[model samples]
Each structure stands twice: as C-alpha cells, then as structure tokens.
Target: MTSTDAFNTQGNATAVTDPHTGETRYNRVPQVTWDFWLVKLLAVTVGETAADLINTSLGLGLTNTSLLMSVFLIVALVFQFAQKRYVPVYYWTTVVLVSVVGTLITDNFIDNLGWSFTPVTLSFTAALAATFAVWYMVEKTLSIHSIYTFRREAFYWLAILFTFALGTSAGDQLAEGLGVGFLMSGLMYAAVIAVIAGLFYGGLMNGILAFWLAYIITRPMGASFGDYLSQPVANGGLGLGTIVTSLIFFAAIGATVWYMTRSKDGLEVAQD
Candidate 1:
C-alpha cells in the first residue's frame, strides 16, 4: 500500500500487486465466486421477466422493447467500461442490462424479423465463435482472470452478448418450437450444466472452456425457468406473473449487490 508499490493501470484496466509475490496483474473483472453465479442467475431471471413485462404487459412490443433496452444497455456499458477496475454495481448493472438486451435481440430476430429458430441459433453460434477466434488471436488467452486490457474486456462483453442471444434462440427452439415446454427446457439445460460442472471438477475440461460453456448455457436455463414461473398455466407455467417474478429476482440482485459493495466479496485487496 505504499506509494513505491508497483501499482499500475493499463489503458484504464487497473493492475494490482499479487499480494504474496507483489507481481502486477490487470484484473478488471470480479473473481469467480459463488455470489458471482448467484447474482448472475438472478440477473438473467430478471431479464426474462422484465422483458415480458415490457413487451407484453406494458405493450411496448418486441421492436420497441428491444430498442429501449439496447439504449439502456449501451448507457450501462459506458459506465462499466469507465471504471478502472471491477465495481460490483456497475458490473452487475451492465450484466442485467446485457441479459435483457440479449434476449430482446433474439426475440426481435424471430418475432419481428420473421427468422426461424434454426437460423437464429446458428447465426449466434457462428458469431460467438468468430468473436472468440478473434479474441484469442489478438490476446492469445481467453481467461476471464486475464481481462486486464480494454480490448479483452471489449471481446468479453461481445462474447457475452452472443451467448445471451444464442441461449434465447436455443431455449425458445427447445421450449416452444419443439413443444418441450419451458419447465422441461430449463431442466434439460440444468442437466447439461451439471455435466459440464462434473467435467470441470474431474479435470476432463479446463477452467476457461468450462466457465464459458456454463456461462453460455446458464442464460437459457435462467430464462426458461423464469418463463415457467411467470407464465400462466395455460402457457405451461405457474402463472406467477412477470411482475412478481421480476420483483423477486431484482430484490435478490439488489441485496446481493449491496452485500458485495459493502464487503467487497471478490476483491482481496482494497485497490480498485
């Protein structure tokens, strides 16, 4: 914590001493933690309900909802990227906005643009692949822990946008297009995520790949479950309503973020 400490900032990405070794590392993102996953799930669950609330209940429709949420997401991302290091409020706020916009993007492709499930899914998959390919080519690493530079952060967010879009498309394909229903779709994705977790813990897969896979799948899983809880029984759901579901999850997100902000859950040192 001395002025002579090798603290540094790489183009707005803050770097801090490694504590034990005093090595500098740019860690702009939060560490992978339980609360991280918790908030992420809650945020995505809110994404589904919030989208429904705006599109159906509020009568904004798909196109208008998409446009509005996209604008909000851009604003949130502006604040997120402005931070030199990880800040829980800005980071999770951006995530919630991204989740909403990602869902809307896919919904627009289908509901508004008249695209089918197969094309939408495939397009997002291809886009996500290209993003990762270019990111790896330039950065030579795809580890979240190494998101110390602006380009890497940019790549990270772009990849996430694709994941959410891909997940929405695939989830709809499974839940509605294939007549699987939302509850079943959520269960299927949950089973797949469980297998991925097992593989990662067993060392059959590396952390980076496993993390991204789970990240991609969780989007659909959360969305599907959210729909199941919020939609009416006529629509194969519990009829809890979108407002109730959104309120529940957003409350959870607010509490988690408050705790994270007060305690600094992921960061070890007081910097950034």
Candidate 2:
C-alpha cells in the first residue's frame, strides 16, 4: 500500500512499543490485499446506495443528509485517528462514513448548487491534485506505508474524500449525462482498472501509483454498479431499491472486516 511492495503488510522490522508509554505504534491504515479491495468496493457501493436511501427514500434531502453524515464521519474519524495502529472497527467505520459523505458532496454540488457535472468533476480533480502536491512537497513521499503521523494521515483522508466525490460526479456524468447505461458505465471503468492492474503486475508501474490508481478507479466502478442495482427498472437499474443494496454491501463489509481482524492480515508495524 506504499512505495514498497503493495502486498507487504508487515515490514522488514518487527513492531515497536514505547516502553515509557506502554503504547504500540504501527501503520494507521491496513495492508493492501484482495480483501482490502473487496471491502473498498463494498464500501463504495454502499456509499452510493446509502446516500440515495437517506436523501430520496428517507426524504431528508441532500443538505440535511450531508450535514448528518458529515457529523458522523467526523466522530468516526476522531476515534480512528486516535489509534496508533490499524483497528478494523474504527478504520472501516470511518471509511464507510467517508464514502457516504463523499456521495453527498457530489450530490449537493450538482443537485443543490445546480452545478454541471463537468465543472464539479474538474473541481474535485483539481482539489485532489493540490492535496497530493502539498503532501508530497512536505513529506517527500506519498506512501500509504508512511501514514504513521497525524499530518500524513490528514493528507490521506483529505485525498480520499476528494476521490469519492470525484468518482461520484464523473460516474454520474458518464452514466446519466451522456446517456451511458449504469451497467455499461460500471463495466467500462472496471475494464480500465483491469488494464491498470495488468500494467502494475507486469512491473511497468510504481506500486504507489498502481495502488492509488486502482483505489480511485474502483470508486466510479463500484458506484456505477451500485446505481445499476438500486435504481428502478425504468431507470435502468434492477429495482432492488437502495435499502436492499445498502444492506447487502454493508453485510459483506462486516464479514470482510471480521476476517481481517481475526487473521491480522492487513496491518503493518511501525518502527521506533
């Protein structure tokens, strides 16, 4: 999940604990693995459906739902970042909250502010680029493996929020603005992601680049699939309803997180 091997959850050195403080310190994020990708996809899918459920199905509207989810995200992240190492419950909870809020951000931008998809997409892209630029300038590395400090973790979360928002807007634009069906849009993004993976595995791409690229691409792909399944048949979806779709994804995420916790498969120890 860093500039190092993408699948290297544990580093060369063993974990360290501060004897004086009796606290363990390790990477704040999880290891990049198949389950990691699985949870990410599930989270993004739930993100799409959860936003629709709260805004349209529950009649909370975009603004209120955004405010409510934003609050929940802040609280969840407060708990997550407080940990010195990866904690599945806290970290995944934050991720799910972030995904929902990211969907809301895009929705509020286009629906409430009446901004066009092109502009919204461009804005989120620029914002993400700026965050990465500043992060690299300060830390000299954008490695996910180096997220052992507050500043790097801040940059990580900020960039993640932008990715979700960007993915949501761009996916909507392709799936609706251009009259591309949601299922096809999902397939298109998935195909592109597959190409990226092929390039990475073929040793033509940097690990960090491959990881982040896949991470970003999965957003649109998962969102598109979520919409296709949750929307009405008249609207090109399978008519499962947002509630059913959300429940399905959340259950999968729960099971995956439980596995990660039990196996300790996604954590890396931080050196002293």
Candidate 3:
C-alpha cells in the first residue's frame, strides 16, 4: 500500500494529505514559524548556560553532570514518545534536556578525553550527515512535515542531538580556541543565518534546505550569546552569571511554550 493508504489505515489523530507528494501524514511535530525558532534559540542558550552552572557553579563536575543530565534526558524522551503526539510541554522539555546533554557530551570529549575542538566538530558533522542519509534512504524524506511515524521522530531527535553537539564544538572552537570572542562569533552566525533567510524569501532556496540551514546555525548562535551573557568579564562575557542567564531564558521559553499550548497558530498542521 502507499504512504497515504498507510496513514489512512493507521487512523492517526491528525492525518492530512500532502498536496505535493500525495502522502498522508499525522503532523506529530510543531509547525515551523517565528515562535518555533524563538523557543529553539532560547532553549539552546539555556542549554549552554545551565550546563556550565551545574558542572562548575554547583560543583557537580563534568562527568557527574553528564551522568545526571543524561538520565533526565532519557526520562524526558520516554514521556515524549509516550505521548505519540506533539505536546508543547513535553516536546520543548525534551529539546531543553537534549540541548544540555549534547553540550555536556561535547564537553566530556574536550575536558576528559582531551580531544580538541576541530576533531569533535568534524566528528559530529559526519555523524549528522550519516543520520540524514540513512533517514532519507529509509523514509524517503527529511522534511519535518512528515514526522508522523515513530521511526521518523527517532531520527529527528537523533539529528537534533548531533546538531547541538556540533554547534557547541564549532562555536567554542571559533570563539575561545581561535580567540574571536563570543559577541563577534554570535554576530558572524547571525549574519550567515540572515543570508540563508534572504535566499529563502527571495525564492532562490528550497524551504527544507533553508529550514535545516537555519536550524544548524541557530545552535552555535545561541551558544555564543549564552556564553557572552554568562561568562565573566575577564573571559569576555557580560558577567551576568549562568544562574541569571539560565533563569531569564527559562522564563522566556516557558512563556513561549505556554502561548503555544493555548494557540492553534503554534501547533503543527499537515500540509494540504
């Protein structure tokens, strides 16, 4: 049977037929919009600051913090998958946890294993590319609009994790390892993302390509901004401290999620 036939047979909660591909999908992820990008950026920023807070300020150490956060991430993913539908709270919660865990994973390689930044970034990039290759080969599409099946969702989260790790490593390499400073690095990423957006709006790029490009760039951009706000003045930051930065972004994310939960405008709808 066809994809549409399979979706119809499954009787999903919100199946709709894709006009372009003639495929039916359940719309298990949120629609890509301004709000979606805003919350995502906040979540990554919190991820960087919060990881530093727990590992350094709280004195948990990198190993201990990674262990603790990894456990929580697993638990969050369990609840997320259990929902079998896009729940704003659970979905964003998972994203936040994954972001933190991804940062910690990269940190472990550098601090514990003594791996350098370039190798870590390259490794994660390769991993993410492989994931996309396999996902496309298996599911025939990498568009977020088709994230209706459990397998697709699994691939989606895995790719997200790699993006976070890759972003962390690349951002740190440029900002700290290369001495570009956090603010400058953030500006660089922002410019690149802006160019990508311009291309999309000008009808020179595909929507899926634009979406993934922005998605990957946002990770480092958020991390750079987070470090700039939270690090000490000696370290080129604003000296706001991790506690304040994390709390501010947490509130922002919470407010956005609350609005998304109440508004159909933020919810995912299958393409007609």
Candidate 4:
C-alpha cells in the first residue's frame, strides 16, 4: 500500500499517530508530492553540476571537494535532526547537501580509486538492499508516512544516501561506461519513471513500491539532465558550463523550498 493508504487504514482521524499507542506524532520529512519531486530533481541536478564546479572549476580536486562537502553535510544534518518536525528550508538544504556528498562519494570511488562502474553500482545496490532489509525488520513497515521516529528518520536518510550513490554510479555507467550520451540517458531514465508512474496511477502496482522505484530513477534522470546542460557541445550537451547549470538548479531548488516554507504546503504534521 502507499503511505497515504497505510495512514488512512490505521486511522483517518489524524495526520499522524502511533500505531501501537494511538498517540499523535509528527513526521520529520515532507509529504511526497509533485512539488517535492520537482525540488528533489533540482537538488540532484545541482548536486552533479555543483560538485563538478567545486572539484574542477574551483580547483579543489575531487578529494578536497569531497572532504569539504562531507563537513558541510554533517553540519546540515545536525540542524536537520535538531528540529522536532519538518521545516522546508532545513529539510531541503540537508537533502541538497546529501546529494552533493553522495555524488562525491561515487566520484571518488571511480576517479580516485579507478574502480569500475559495474562493481561500484553493484556494491551500492547491495548496501541499499541491506538497509531496507534491516529497516523493515526493525520497524515492520517502510512507509514514508511512518517516519515519525528518530530511528525511522535515520533509516530514511541512510536509504536516501545509498540511493544517490547508486544512482550516480548507475548514471555514469550508462552514460560514460556504456557510451550513451547524456541527453539520451536522461530521456531513457525519464521514460522509465513515466512507466512506473503509469503503473502506480493505474492501480497495477503497490504504492510504496512505486514510490521507491520512481525515487531511485529520478537520481539518474537528474544526473543525466545535469550533465547534458553542463558539458560542452562536443560532449553532446548545451555547453552551459558547471557554474551556469548549478546556479540555475540552485535557484529552482531555493525557490521551491521558499514556497514550501511560506505555504507549509508539503509540511508533515498531525491532524486533529
């Protein structure tokens, strides 16, 4: 079932509730919606372009950039976890930082260690599967709607990190390793997401399954889209350069988060 379905099934009287105690709880994450997904795509795209800008254009190198972004991610997470409930600005900022860190982690594995994309992709896939397995074993549910506890939030973030890493490796594998160009790769991933959405809306697929599937695909889609915008024309892109690409996506993400903050449109909260 989808998270909304699960929530309704448990109790339709509230925005959130403890299944065991029937006490109201608040989610620390935003509700999944069109806007949420849009911002997420922007965040991942910025992750790709911003990482390239910092590592190459700014001459920080992959290792240095990774180190710096890692520190930033830790600080972002500190503020994110400190909040008792969802705050759009804090939540999206943490997501953006996580996206950058995830890209750097994958880049380091490939460029610095000379690891093949196949192994890197496989390893991250295994890690994500393991995380889900453990999370389900402990929580008995993987519904995003149930992410009202610290432990669940931790598992949620870990899954997100792995998804970003896996997406980076898989995107690179398809575009660079397998010789597909960025635009084509982006189109391919977008097509897959469309199919998944069709299945979900058609009632042929489980909601949680569809949500996670679309989530995973968006990473590669965003990566390919970013590369297409930022790379040179000879490389089958728009030749926008990393700076321009990053700035565009960063502005998009910031605007979306600001809207969410002002409207509280996607904020997760309990209903009375």
Q: What are the Cα lDDT values of the candidates?
A: 0.82, 0.85, 0.84, 0.85
Model 1 clash pairs are: none
Off by more than 4 A, model 1: 1-26, 268-272
Worst 10 residues of 1 by lDDT: 2-11
Tens digit of per-residue lDDT, candidate 1, span 94-168: 999999999999988888899999999999999999999999899876766567667889999999899989988
Backbone clash count, each prediction separately:
0, 1, 0, 1
Report each candidate's C-alpha RMSD, comma-separated, in the order given.
Answer: 6.4, 2.8, 6.4, 3.4
Per residue, candidate 3 scores C-alpha lDDT tens digits across 195-251 of 987886676877667777778888889998999999999999999999999999999
Worst ten-residue run, lDDT, model 2?
2-11
Model 4 over residues 54-143: C-alpha lDDT tens digits?
999999999999999999999998898887678898899999999999999999999999999999999999999999999999988886
Q: Is candidate 1 or candidate 3 better by lDDT?
A: 3
1-272 per-residue lDDT for model 2 (tens digits): 44245533233445657678968768898877777888999999999899889988999888999999999999999998899888988999999899999989988888889999999999999999999999999988786766888998999999999989998888778767667888988899999888887887787876667777777888889998998999999999999999999999999999999998998877876642
Where's the lowest-lDDT run of ten residues in candidate 4?
Answer: 1-10
* True-structure Cα RMSD, model 3: 6.4
Error of 3 at 101 (Å): 0.7
Question: Model 3 compared with the native: what TM-score?
Answer: 0.89
Would you estimate the TM-scores of all the predictions? Answer: 0.88, 0.91, 0.89, 0.91
